[model samples]
Target: MKPLLLEIGTEELPVGALPGLAQALFDGVVDGLVKRGVAIERDDAKPLYSPRRLAVLLPGVAAEQPEQRSEVLGPYVNIALDAEGQPTRALQGFAAKAGVDWTRLERTTDNKGERFVHRAVTPGAATAALLPEVLAEAIAGMPIPKPMRWGTRDSGFARPVHWLVLLHGEDVVEAALFGVRSDRMSRGHRFMHEGPVWIAAPGDYVDALRAAHVLVDPDERRERIVREVREAARAVGGVARVDDGNLEQVNCLVEWPDAVTCSFDEEFLAVPAEALVATMETNQKFFPVLDEGGRLTPHFIGVANIESKDPAEIRKGYERVIRPRFADARFFFEEDLKQGLASMNEGLRTVTYQAKLGSVADKVARVAALAESIAPKVGVEPALARRAAELSKADLQSRLVNEFPELQGIAGRHYAAAAGEPAEIAAAIDEAWMPRFAADAIAPSPLGRTLTIAERLDTLAGGFRAGLKPTGNKDPFALRRNALALARTLVEAGIDLDLDAALEAAGADVAEVREFILDRLRHYYAEQGVPPQQFEAVAATHPQSPADFDRRLKAIAEFALLPEAEALAAANKRIRNILRKAEGAIPQRVDAALFAEDAERELAEAVDAAIADTDTALAQRDYVAVLGRLARLRPQVDAFFDQVMVNADDPAIRGNRLALLQRLADRLGSVAAIEHLSS
Candidate 1:
């Protein structure tokens, strides 16, 4: 075995796409080696990358592929040899293709008859001889979103390629990519080192680059960035908010990273922290510093690509670059405060929400109506929820939000508070957009939860009405995300509002929208560790309320773990199938005098008792207790199916037996369609 290294040097690649591009490159090479029959230790392989380069290093790779062999089956003996026991035309042709005499070919026996076989073997070629093709194939498949060509090259890549490196076990493996030939030479940091660096072996790549002031490994670079930012924040007596996103982008933008503390006038702190943080992180990629209680501080950290001798100068440059953005934000804040949040709603009447859904004002009105209708049911003042909904989308017209689009809801919260609205209403205005992403938290306040459900209901209604439903990956309106959020808010908040009624009031097709929203739960519960069978079992009951669906799903999940669960589930399935195939109308009530078997009478008695025992629990949606009560009937159910002939010769007796099974099936499906769990 031998170690291998491959590097592709280029002009600065896209910072946001650097990590994915590097991963794709690493996977492509590994796949290529395996497809070519080259053995490798995947655990020992690493991908190293920076803005200027993408590299892959393998600590152990096969020196050569294993020996190649093949076998071909020829015509059967009866066809190969005629009645005279002589070679036929088919045998001669087979031997010619095998490059051997017909008599030398081996014979193998099968069920049909004897057949001739041709076996061939050849020695594997040297790994070095195949490296060029393997490396070229790997490079040709890189996922570059927008490939660019440099100077007169016919082909394009993510960036203009400047150099290539391919080394194996201290030897240069010859390969070429994008008008450049592979060699041991690699360029160092653009400013820190002026000359090319020499790589003697694949094992020495990291150390050699570190000496050249280039931290080639992305993980090491990211860790150093986090530590430096934290220490810098501590020096300023605050904690830096080093989010994964900003850290990753910063790591890609630098080869050697160093954090420097910078600050703005405390006056800029009066602006919304989210806006200021957006300006720093989103616009400039700086890490914001926060006080112990998580309030934003004036001090922030910027990671520089170089360790300058005059660190103060770098700090000054960083301060100067951020000053204008902060000042603009401060001005926008003051202007918006002067204008007040109420005035922001006037322009919304003219702004279109969607072509088919009317103006933004229309959406606000729909959301307001829905919120007011649902508030009292979920324990909130209708007027307060309606007021929050009215101001919910007003921030879309604010100057601060215009500059920072992600702060739509957050900007409204600040404006509402500044306008003398109640604290809960202000918080609700922002919380209305809770769980803005997959990993975000849902609304924690009653009024906020009301507004969230209302807004998502309105959005989903308009989206489905406009025919913008997601098909495969083409969700332009993000309706799938909105549906999942809607479901999550209802279930997580413990709100049991009727989903079908709400959708009907919002002018949506209740059945279609309900099914659409429930479908997203398939993925949601998969992440929650709930099996699909359990989820589908509850879904089959068509619980119109999301909270009820959640209740039944939990009950089914618990039921699946019981000792009698499997047999009960199987019995329910059998009963369902039996009832489904009845020749005549199955009677709803079973006559006591018609029971011909003791097993039938026992099952009937058990079914009635179980129903009476679980009646109150069923009405209250305490599905766990209801299912537990139903599980006890498993023994009677098993005995009845074993002893009774459901299709009896007497028509009256047959109808009664089917009726008994039908009664059991209905009760079994009361909590969930347990039959889904059978298989």
Candidate 2:
């Protein structure tokens, strides 16, 4: 056994397309090898991904597939044989289809009492002999996320393939991929090396690429970039800092990285710090400068594909590109402040949030009203919630936000404070978008949470009313994000604000909003790392408020630990069975006097005590306490079921026992219905 090496050389591929291509190439090869009965030594196969190439090395690949036998089902014996005990045309056809002779066919009785004919034989083929065809089919079917057409070929792929190296144990495995013929030769770096590098075997794959000026390992390339940048920055008296985000992009941009220091005018700092950094990061893909005190400096660091003779030349090139971008940002900032926050707030009226829903100004009014209505429930002053809502979207009309749309909320905070708005109002303006992502921190202040929830609810309700629901990753209005934000705020604030009522207060025009929120709550729990079953259990009990769903989860968590919690659940299930049999009329109160047996009385007392404890524990949100009390009643419940007949011949006794079980069902349903629990 020897190693096999392959590399698909192409023109410079986009950084984004590299990961998917590498994964598909590696996976497709492995799947093809497995399907062909070629056992690949796990340690022998390695994949390396670079922007310009995707390579796979297979060590110690088997030369041939093991022989195997297969059984083939044929026509029924009755059909294969005529009434005169002679072979019919069906037997000949079946034998031909099975690729065997009629004499080789055997008969067996099937499950339906019908005799069937079958054939058994060994298959012949070398694994290496089958490789080219299967490998070709797999590569042809590779799922590229985004493909392109290059050269004269209409075939679309991630990149145009220039060379393909396919070596199987020092032997050339002739194959073709996307019109490119494969052999034993691969290419090196497009700029630094110019040659057809011959791969001796799979073991030589990495070393061969390294010699040709390509660092084959992605992690190693990233490490080299980080190490070189740090050294280059330290060489300069002014320290350099590479943004982690830009470092990630640069990692995918080049196989071999050479870091260079760049500097710009200190006057660029006069532009807002954010604008300067954005100009460097967004446009130039450069790291911003930082002083000893960690304040952003005027210098930046750029990672280049080639090491230039004069580093200063690269610095000049970067400065030339970034200067004009910063100048525009500075102009926008000054022009925006000229109109001031109040004028920007007034301009918001002209901006449409949704054509059918109304303008952004109308959204602001709805948010303010919703916030005011929720203020009492959230324990925030009504006036403060309204004030925060009014200022929340004022920055949407700001020139700064218009220029950098990502800074919508941040600009509002800055502009509000500049206009001498109250500190709470200014903070709320920023906090309204409190959780941009699922794990992002929620609003900490009461007033901020209220305003955030109100704004998000208004957006969600309005968009839902317009039937702009997200489906299959098509959330144009980001209604999913808005719902997630609402769920998190409700849970984090620990407020039991009824979402259905809140939706009504927020002008509920969509009947499916509750279902939408429930779906988002499941997403939210999934983000929190909760198991799907536990999330469903909680949602089954509390479908109204996201906060209640969270509380139900807490109850389930505590209940899961009680010694008899499972048995208690079983008892609750049995009680629900008895109550369900009692028909639709549920008895509100248990009649202890009507209890004809000691078991019934004991069960009634146990249920009443459990209900009281469960109610207290629920009031204090002490789910553990509720579970403990419920656990204590489990034995008594079991005893009642074992000793007493729930549906006695006497109607009064049966009704009393049924009412006792109904009480048990109510208490358990308050947490989570046992019927919904799965084993």
Candidate 3:
């Protein structure tokens, strides 16, 4: 085994593009090696990247490709031979092309009938001989959204390539990538290293780069940045708020990192903390410092590419660059306050939400009406819910929100509070967009939850009514996310609103929208480790209430663990198949006089007793108890299917047996269609 290394040195890459490029390079190289029959463990391939380079190191790679068996198909066997059973002209030509004697060719039979084939074992080639093609393939497959050409060269890449390194053990792999000749030399930090750093062997790459003042490994660079930022913040008597995004961007912006503490004017601290943090993190890529109470301090930490001799100068430069952005934020905040949230809402009338869905103000009106209707259902005051919904989109017209679109809801919360609105209303304005992303928290207040559901419903209704449902990856309206958020709020938050009725109230097709919501639930529960079949069982009944659907699913999951679950599920399936084939509709009422067989009589009795015992449990929505009670009838159910035949020659007997099975199936399916659980 030999260690393998490949590095592509380039001009500074976009910070946002570094991580994805590294992963894509690693995957492409690993796939290339595997496809060429070069043995290498997946875990043995390591990705190392900094702002100026992307590298993949393989610790244990085969020195040569494995010997392989080759086969080539020829003409059909019958056509390959003459009437006398001697080789024909076609067989002779095929054997010659395959470099084998006609007699050595074998006959094989497949779905398409007999065919003549050539088979042989061939020796493998050295891994070094295949490196040029493999390396080219890996580079050609990089995920460069926009490839650039440098000089007059035809080759295009994410960035202009300056150097290439391809080494196998102590030997340099002869190849040219991105119009640059592959060699053992790699460039380091442009300022720290004077020239190219020579790597003696594949294993010496990391140490050689480190000695040149470059942390080639992104993970190590990120850790260093984080530790330095925290220490810098500690020096100023505050804790550093190093968001993951800022840390990652900083990691990609520098090959050598040094965190410097800087501060702005104390008056700038009066700006909304979110606006300040956004400006610092987004525009400047700086980590803000916070007091013990989680309030933003004037001090912020900026990551520098070099360790300056006069650190005070670097600090001053950092503070100098951020002052204008802070002033802009402060001005935007004060100006927005003067307009007030209600006044800002007036500007929404001219903003279009969608071409066919009317203006933003129209959406607000619809959402407000829906919120008023759903408020009482979720135990919130109708007036409060309507007020929150009305002002939720007002932030879109704010200067801060226009500058930082991600702060839409956050800005509304701040503005509403400044206007002296009720705390619930202020919080609800922001919470209405709760679960802005998959991992975000749902609304905490009842009023917030109510408004969230109402807003999402209006969006869904308007989008679908405009014929803009999501198809493939083109969800311009984000219907999938809207549906999942609605379902999560209803089921996880314990809201008992009828999803179907809510859709109807919003002027959406109730049946179609209900299916859409349930489809999202199917995926939502599967992600939580629930089986698709478990969700389908409850979904088969098409429950209108998401809460009821959730309860039934919980019962089904627990019931599935019972030893009798398989037999019960299988029996339910059998009953359904029988009912489908019946001559006519099965009578709802089962007559005892028609129960001639003992198994049928016993099943009827068990059905009656189970239904009688489960009435209170079902009414209370005690699904677990209801399912457990139904499990007791599995023995009688099994016996009826085993001994009684539904298609008996006697018309009365067949009808009675069909009705009996129908009653049993209805009782079992009242909670869930257990038949879906069958294997």
TM-score of each: 0.96, 0.92, 0.96
For model 1, the local distance difference test gives 0.91
Order of models, best lDDT first: 1, 3, 2
- lDDT of all the models against the reference? 0.91, 0.77, 0.90
After superposition, candidate 2 runs with Cα above 4 Å error: 43-47, 114-124, 143-146, 230-245, 289-294, 509-511, 584-586
What alpha-carbon RMSD in Å does predicted model 1 have with respect to the real structure?
1.9
Give the per-residue Cα lDDT of candidate 3 at 174.
Answer: 91
Q: Quick one: best lDDT, which candidate?
A: 1
Clashing pairs in 2: 65-127
lDDT of 1 by residue, 615-660 (tens): 9999988899999999999889889878989999999999999998
Q: Taking the tens digit of each residue's C-alpha lDDT, what string does model 3 give over 460-517?
A: 8888899998999999989999999999999988787888788999999887887898
Arranged by TM-score, best first: 1, 3, 2
Candidate 3 clash pair list = none
Worst 10 residues of 2 by lDDT: 112-121
Kindly give the stretch of ten consecutive residues in candidate 3 with the minimal lDDT sum: 39-48
lDDT by residue for model 2 (130-214), tens = 7678666656766776778876777677778888888887788777877878887877777788877778876787888888878
Q: Flag regions of model 3 displaced more than 4 Å.
A: 76-78, 83-86, 101-116
